[model samples]
Target: MTLMASDTSADVVIVGTGVVGCLVAERALDAGLSVLMLEAGPRVDRWRIVENYRNLPPSMRLFHWDAPYPPKPWAPHLETRVAKESEQYLQLEGPNARAYLQGYVRYAGGATWHWAGICWRLTPEDMRLKSLYGVGRDWPFGHDVLEPYYTAAEYAIGVCGPSDPALQWPPNAERSKPYPMGPIPFGPGEKRLTEAAARIGMMNLPAPQARNSGVSYHGRPPCCGNNNCFPVCPIAAKYDAATALPKIEAKGGKILANAVVYRVETGEKNAVEAVHYFDPNKVSHRVTAKLFVIACNGIETPKLLLLSKDDRNPNGVANSSDQVGRNMMDQPKLFAEVELAEPLWTGVGPVQSSSILNTTQGEFRNRYAGAMFRMENFARSPLGSAAALKKGLVGKALDTEIRRLSACTARLTVEHEPLPLPINRLTLSSKTDWLGINKPNIYYDVSDYVRRSAKEYTVPRLQQLASELGATSFQLSPEFLNSDHIMGGCIMGSEAATAVVDADCRAHDHQNLFLPGGGAMPSGTASNSTLTMAALALKAADAITAQLKHG
Candidate 1:
């Protein structure tokens, strides 16, 4: 099929309008470079998403964080509400396929639209896992190199975190700058957990979050604690890409929504010359640029590369190493909930406010993966109320049950660091979407390292913590779950033979092409990876800026 004569041109062409892509656009545009961002999903407003959540049937609302933002036919993300329902879109196999059923939105701003806004930085030790622990591969650069970018990202997204150095996570990574604002006040549940954890020799610190704590920064209002952060922040308190698009456009960057990128075209020297995308009408349009960046997360970026095959490079663009969709990693997660003998009143503030930092590091990492534990701050109202009403309780009994569960129930979650394995990967499925693009087929499994960590350390520690909370009944999930922190698809390395991108996030085969974000991450530490992904994006932006200046 003949594509339309180069539909448009720009200094930089970016695929995926997620936080990483949008942040890069902001930096590139600020540096006076014209950028064209193509998003496969529709451009939705905050109000629309909030209304969608409100209109959902009461029963579905609790598990409907990613449901309200339905997938567009052209660009589908994993539908995780139900496995059987989502299988038609994402083909899953292997032992841990169910855990890989992630919850992410394809719309502009991507998954951050429904994220809890937690931000954790990797320690220098995390980057040197192979050198320090003899386990995973080491990053080309260390945490110190990314620290500046982390600081920049925190300010860019208006992160509020602890000012005390002791309270910061991954304690070994020194900070050059304090957070933009002081930490958000911990919820009642977090306070209770912190006290209980201290008695048992655990350290629970306030989590660094991207949402504004008090004073508004970057035009976003402060978080009002509406407790609807997952589906969508009722108000624009959290930093989502939607809040950045207008500013990006104000700086002359253009965004084309509902533009599904299908193929990447390479020219002389195997450099990325252009990309082909399908519009909402299924008409093909070729977009040319001097430089191109694919920040479509772990799955879609590699899928696009595999789809773009040619004689000069038959193994897919930038996949000379055959690592495009390989080494996919996520923090295998477990949840432990208990009915406390006393009311803890968990729904006081943001969804998640604090976590135990003690177990995230140690010499034990050489044998088993590390884990981070946190108290889920979601108010028990919606879930408890719904369950009570379903039990056929009328007025007084219903109110009593709801109050008891909402105030007394406490939850703890353990997120484990999983070692990267080439066998756990993503491929193109035989099934096709409305646009005829083949859906993604993924095979995933949590390594024994993580399983061992849960069995030996995290689970037992969590059970002890729950017991210390004076729980009447406590139970931990039997199986590992996906934490939604996707990483290591287009992994970075020093050698071109083993990695798709280099330390600078530039494709080894295509100098002008970059695949940043979590996809370029070489390691998945036990923490929320959004801040790390943003740091990598900023680091890549600096390299792209320098390349444009010299060339």
Candidate 2:
């Protein structure tokens, strides 16, 4: 619902209605503080997105998940499917330009609307990268500090995974409690891959997913194996932020959709007083609050900070260290398509049910990056059918080829952790969107650390795994694809000179402002970074609660 003029002032003003923002709002409202959320995209419903998918042409439907959730012209996001289209938003530069065309939907819910729902927590060692690995910076605190918050985030998002410690993703990290729901059973493909990985002395664990498993939890339904978790979940079995908006409203929180936040206005003592946003018709509105937060993902959060320059902070708000839009990161992934000799039946469960955790850490990280390998559990029928038809095979021949490829084809991906580099960054582009807001331009390259991991560690291991599966052909990707876990633009550290935010994700330069999300992550571990981002949000929420109470 749109916020009225009287609702302008709040205890907390959150920019972005994504999962991170929604969680923060939930906690702050739970503390009896009023919250006003500003979202750039329109409020959309599940049925509308499902119908949009159904209305697409067969070819477009096969590979174009982004087509269903078309971005509002005023709030455009990255779309790789049609990179040359009118609303190609994210401006890419550097040699690895095309690789950064991330597919995150800009709607009321944000990217969680289309995520695979795999939630992997960061390991204790992952937090202390500098002390242990000597590669990247360490977090201000360790896993023990964030473990309780991780448990809270899992329950908040309705995550289900194996209770067995041996079956956990980071098999070494101690768990305070079991997952919210029972583990999802392994499918035939996951079972086969697990066996194959075992032969190579690796561990394949059932991935912790935010989707419900057997029974409904937190208002979401159980997973029915619809296999449509990419573009949108047809059922409400998966957790997304859209589901949280109404709950926030019911608790006296206000949300304004199609409210594009442009500038952050500072009042005194390096405090964020108010924010300026534009409506869909380019009508400007200002909302003031005691505290402010920017949770518009990694790219937009940094871009917004850079755009909010003022007299005291001429460089930008909270950018005294020049760390607002620097040290950009994403998990650079390597793809391998194997034509196995046996049928795997991959589409029996969620899009990503399991992953090999053996390569995620070791003493070898000092030289190269860590890798997490997993099976791409998307159904191969439509993809195989489309490819066969395009090759002039029709009727019986097409049917035979489609069945063969669908049953035997298995795609494996290895996600490598790239160290945060100041050179790899995002800047406001000279070009502007329809709203006259400067677009984000990125310069990124997977450093040689990641390349060395692929060459020395992951590639050889993937080949061995493919051979163990008795593959006919194993083809490796020539270039890296993004895991879409954008991170490190507004990095967290103990010192103000080196980091944008502190351990609590509160801006070091502005005590009353917080930038909590993947962008606050200091190191981009090989796992899906959502759980860590959620945990950070919860931690930030507590900090904000304490500040409001004692101050």
Runs in model 2 lying further than 4 Å from the true structure:
1-6, 80-87
Per-residue lDDT of candidate 1, residues 278-346 (tens digit): 998999999998899999888889889989989988988899999988998999999987888899888
- Tell me how far the alpha carbon of residue 338 in candidate 2 is from the true structure, in angstroms, after superposition: 1.4
Q: How far out, in Å, is residue 172 in model 2?
A: 4.8
Clashes in candidate 1: how many? 0
Model 2: per-residue Cα lDDT over 394-447, one tens digit each = 889888999988999989999998888998888999889989999999998888
* Best candidate according to lDDT: 2
- Per-prediction TM-score to the true structure, in the order listed: 0.97, 0.97
> Once superposed on the true structure, which residue ranges of model 1 sit more than 4 Å away at CA?
1-7, 80-87
Model 2 clash tally, residue pairs: 0
Give the Å error, residue 482, model 2: 1.0
How big is the positional error of residue 371 in model 2, measured in Å on the Cα after superposition? 0.5
